[model samples]
Target: MNKRLLAIIAAIGATTIYGINHTVAKGIMPHYVQPYGFIILRVLGAAILFWLISPLGPKEKIDPKDYLRMIVCAFLGMGLNMLVFFKGLSLSTPINSAVLITTTPIIVLVLSAVILKEKISSRKILGIGIGLFGALGLILYGSEVRQDAPNIPMGNFLIFLNSIFYGSYLVVVKALITKYHPFTFMKWLFSLGVLICLPFGLEEFMQIEWSSLPFEAYRGIAFVILGTTFCTYLFNIFALTQLKASTLSAFVYVQPLVGIGYAIFTGQDNLTLIKIVAACFVLVGVYLASRKPNRFYQKLK
Candidate 1:
């Protein structure tokens, strides 16, 4: 199969895992493992897995200049992205987190325009606006007083912060994706992520009562380490080589669908008409935003 198809599949797979993670991770946090502790587990486990496989890939060395860039990717993608997201998910409903994550594509578009100086067509701008409206609509109407989610507003805000940092990470890492093997970059990126996040997570990590935890909690933790972190990040970084950052980020639109489905399946959330409509807007907006410009428009220009 062509790399493009493979990249598209990778993007979809990564987002699907992330969508499910909203509920799975929520099932374990603030009880079995707090958010910070879970971040530590995710980064550390994924980092080790990347390191273990790095030697199997090409043995190219990273350029010294790119080291700084790698560090920034780690800080934004691995550290800030996961830390805030899990914290927010802990305090927000899975469905709400799912909807807010759909904003990532818009953030990516803005970052791409500003940092990469990528030109945006009027159609894409309209798509971005429509997507933003849907995302904000979800944030406003989706807020609920749940037993597990205590602070919907604050949690949603933090999740939005995560989207910004994650969007910036995609733009920042695009240049480096072609320079090194995915495993090589990931090993270093997550190593730095662990170091940077250690201070905040250590206390929480220490609080885990490993022996007393139930089997289900263990399964949730393992799913986060193996499925959510190791597999998803690897898939996304690999896809970045074959697709534009905006194109890959557009897959975030799938997360809400995936997340809401999982939530509904598990009897954790109820569906609503407003959510259905908001999802429609986001899906249509992402399609328009990620599409290649029309040939007629190019010719007319």
Candidate 2:
């Protein structure tokens, strides 16, 4: 199999986990475990897993300067990304969260141009505008008050911030992705993740009443720790080795479809005409943004 094909699969797999995660992780929050506390569990569990498997990858030493970049990556990707996302998800519906996250690719495209000096064609810019419009429409107009979602507006804002943090992380981590094995990179990023998340999450982490929680709650927690955090991050880093950050982030377009499907299948959410239209906009925008140039154009360039 081609490495780039495998990377696409990896990126798809990561988004699939994330799609399910909107509901799976939400199933455990506030009632069973608070969001910040859940962040601690995810970071700690993934960090441990990364370290345990680190020996399987080729041994490599990090350049001293790269450690700083790694820390920033950890802070953005693992710490703030997980922190704000979970907190926001807890206060928002699964469908809304799913739809808004598609903003990541646009953010990634912009950041890549600014930081990496990557060129953006006019088509991509138009796609970004259309996608942003759809996302913002959903954020502003799609409001359904649920018992679970306490503050949809604030939650949506935080989720948007989470996308920004995650988009920035993609660009930052791209610098280091090819320099080390996935295990080596993940181990250190997650290790620093534990430290960066500790202060904000510790008090909430201490508040959990462990023994009294139900099996479903435990299942949710386990899914987050193992399926969402560990596997998704691992898959994404591997994909990064073969795909550009913009390409990888473009897979976020799949999240809402998968997320809404899972949400509907599980009776957690309902579909609306607005949502369907927004999903179309997002899908088309992603296609336009991620499309490759013709062979002639490629050769000319």
Candidate 3:
């Protein structure tokens, strides 16, 4: 297959995994592993999986200078990013958490402009503004979610913080991945991410009730490992090798639509006119931001 087709396939696969993983994590897995513990295993499992696929040895000669830059990306991207998000997920309702997290793309665009010196077009900026308005509407409606889901406002705050780190991770990935092997970067990134995250997560890991948790908990754990932890990041690195960070991060806006669609399919949420309108705005905004300008638009200018 051509590189473009391969990149599209990878993006779809990654987005599906990420969207479903949120449903599983926020809707299901909190039944067993607390947030921090869950994140630890995610990193640990991903670290092991990447290692099995691409062995990391002390003898590999990645210049410490370059490797260290990637390590900082890991610290911000995987380590602290996961820390804040799972903490938020642990403390609050998934609907609010997921919806608030959608704002990352807006944050990402601003950060990209400032940190990476990527130029933002007027159309993209307007899209981001509209996307934020839609996201806020979701957040307002999301607060009415049934008490079955947790509502830790602290968790919500952390998840937003996670959005920042995640944005930074992408910029760094875009800058570095071309010069290094994607798998090489993945192996070391997760390895260092685990190391950076360990201190915060270790206490929670020790306290988990492994014996009492159901066998199904293990199943959920596996879903997180395969879908959320390993594949999502790897797919990201793979796609970013071909596409820019802005293109990849644009996928963030589509996730809520995915979540809502899944909810409707499972009979968990009723499809409403308001939600349809909200979803359309988000999609329109994302399209304007992520896609290249049309020839007609360029000619008009």
Return the top candidate by TM-score. 2
Candidate 1 lDDT by residue in tens digits, 1-301? 9999999999999989989998999888787899999999989998899899998898888899888898899889999998999999898878877887877766777777786577888899998888777777766766676788888778877888898999888778877876777778888888999999899899999999999999999999999999988888778768877887657655766788899999999987777787778777777776677666332221111
Clashes of 2: 0
**How many residue pairs clash (N, CA or C atoms closer than 3 angstroms) in each of the candidate models, in the order given?**
0, 0, 5
Candidate 2 lDDT over residue span 16-48, tens digit each: 998999988877888999999999999899989
- Against the unseen true structure, what C-alpha lDDT does each candidate score? 0.82, 0.82, 0.67
Q: All candidates: CA RMSD in angstroms?
A: 4.3, 4.0, 5.0
The stretch of ten residues in a row with the least summed lDDT in candidate 2 is: 292-301
Worst 10 residues of 3 by lDDT: 292-301
Model 1 has an lDDT value of: 0.82
lDDT of 3 by residue, 188-255 (tens): 88888788888887887787888997876788788888887877766765786677555665566667
Residue 41, candidate 2: Cα error in Å is 0.4
lDDT of 3 at 125: 88
Which regions of candidate 2 are displaced past 4 Å? 1-12, 235-251, 293-301
What is the Cα-based TM-score of model 1? 0.87
